[model samples]
Target: MTQSLAKRVEQIAPFQVMAVMARAKQLQAQGEDVIHLEVGEPDFVAPKAVNDAGQAAIANAQTGYTAATGLPELRQAISDFYQTRYQVDVAPERIIVTPGASGALILLSSLMADVGSEVLMPDPCYPCNRNFLTQVGAQARMLDCSANPDFAIDLDTLAQQWQAHTTGLWLASPANPTGSVLSKEYVAKAWQIVQQQGGHLLVDEIYQGLVFEGEDFTALSVSEDIFVVNSFSKYFAMTGWRLGWIVVPEWAVEGATKLAQNLFISAPSIAQYAALKAFDQDVLAECEARRQTLASRRATLIAGIERLGLPVAASPQGAFYIYVDVSSLTDDAMQWSLDLLEQEFVALTPGADFGQRDAHKYVRFAYTCDDARIEEALQRIERFIAA
Candidate 1:
């Protein structure tokens, strides 16, 4: 008998971030001093309080599976987080804790879309969004986002792109790779369009607390039909904890709960327990300090890249990434990135992995490294560009 993969599995594309990270690791193993700026993890350690809570949970034998919906305390804490930070009201019952923000996306796609349904998102979005849609047998459509508009979603363009088959929209505020934050006004307008078309809006807020420029916007503030997804990974420096939660509308709660029960069983018990303490005053302050660090790194890196003659397609107002136009240097970004790794020992992501709109002429640099490491990378990149 011949073994075969399912059609959906066969159709799914590999995550480009992992591929770049793997290649960087392979080169480093060969005695190369690679400066990795390809991955999206924070360079700092998780806060002490969060660590202490995890240790305590382990000591107290809290390693068992939690409720599929999550522990009451963690849910309540997440509810309070939204209320306090965003001034939005969210009941604890509306929150569903999952393995990570990625898990939430999977559950959401399953609950909201089906075979032949379409999910619309901006180009140069996080690759996993499209992959998750394909895994669930949904069509992923890309909306063209221009560099002149800072890679933000334009309402007129979206209206034109919306189809009768479209069932949902996935938007990222403080978007990954671009770091563009969607304004509350823009989100409201977009929500209006979605509602008029009988669709749902899924807003990824994983980078919520990392905004450095204007005030952060929450989707729930715009409309109740919006699904707000957030994680402890980015802002809290809890990448390995793999704990996140979603705020669903009252109508979607029952379906999301049932799906969560069947698919995830529950989020990690110890991690959820640890995350409950993440809302304490001291812990919140520590997280803010980390955000300040990222802000500093953003400023430093943007200046450095601009000085190197690369045009920043968008100045990231939130997330710790700087997406630059590299067409003048080379149109083959994948090759440019590989050459950078080999010759300059600097690892970055090629733009083609993000979208089909001349992404090959661009590259994304993560400034999640420390000040000294960032400086060294800038110096190396400058020398490479000069040569």
Candidate 2:
């Protein structure tokens, strides 16, 4: 008899871009030059201070596992960061550091979700979020958010879609794929609605520091009760360090700590130590410079695409991606993405990776590379369309 796999395992969908990315890599190995606009990773390395601190930790042999809740100093630094950056007063006691924002999501999902529970989110969101809910046997109910400006969920969508079994709402500001931020006013309204409905509001602020044109409002600024997920990976440029933290209400701290202990045991001790330097003024200045670079790149890419007559469903105000409407180009974004990769050696993420709501008409481009490469890619795209 064949051994059966867990049903939850079957529920998880593949990260579709990985296949395209893998193919890109395979072609690169065979000597093809590929322009990658598929992945959301930044091209910068960790700040010098952060790298130095990590090196010092390694020299001092500070590689032991930290407490499941993470280092006290790091937590305090995060608290201070909130106070200075967002003007929000968050107690360090409410913070729990994990492997990455991914780990934090797992911890929160475990704490709040149960079998058969529904977690509401927007369609065309980060694809992995639904899988995180599924890992705990909870359902991810994606409400169609195309009608909303910025492709973010508004109070009306929340009211219409939130069912009795809905446990909480998972949100992202400076969201993936689309790179649109939910407005502070919208968040405040949604928070009040969730509270009235007796459900939780979880905001993914992983891209908090990357906004270009407006105030970078942390969800914590709206309410102390909201669960805020942030990471060192994005603006801090510490992707491989695998460090992130969650700020929950004081009541959830103990339970979250217990879950963190059982699940992660702790975040990396070295990374925790290094993250302390992430708060230094010099390091922050460097990161800010990089942010400015990304902003310029964003302007260039958007202008180029628009000049080529491609439609951007929602113009991104933050993060490093632009989700373009490819309906005029082709009805099948998935196949179109593959054809671009094959013919022009340009790789972009297809909408299939995000969600099924009009997905075939959308494609996301990452401005993670330098301006020169982005310009080259646009030129190639214009030529491909002409042909």
In the order shown, what is each candidate's alpha-carbon RMSD? 1.2, 0.9
Q: What is the C-alpha lDDT of each candidate?
A: 0.87, 0.91
lDDT of 2 by residue, 1-387 (tens): 999999889888887788789889989998998998998897899998998999999999999988889999999999999999888899999999999999999999999999899999888898888998899889898888787787777676577677889989989998988988888998899999899889999999999899997679999989999999999999998999999999999989999999999999999999999999999999999999999999889999999999899989886988899999999989999989988898899999999979879989999999989999999999989988898
Please write out the lDDT profile of model 1 over residues 173-254, one tens digit for every residue.
8988888888888888889998888899999999998899877878988877699899999989899999988889999999
Model 2 worst lDDT window (10 residues):
153-162
- Relative to the true structure, candidate 1 has a C-alpha RMSD (angstroms) of 1.2
Worst 10 residues of 1 by lDDT: 11-20
Predicted structure 2, TM vs. truth: 0.98
**How high a TM-score does candidate 1 get?**
0.97
Question: Which candidate comes out best when scored by lDDT?
Answer: 2
The lDDT, on a scale of 0 to 1, for candidate 1 is 0.87
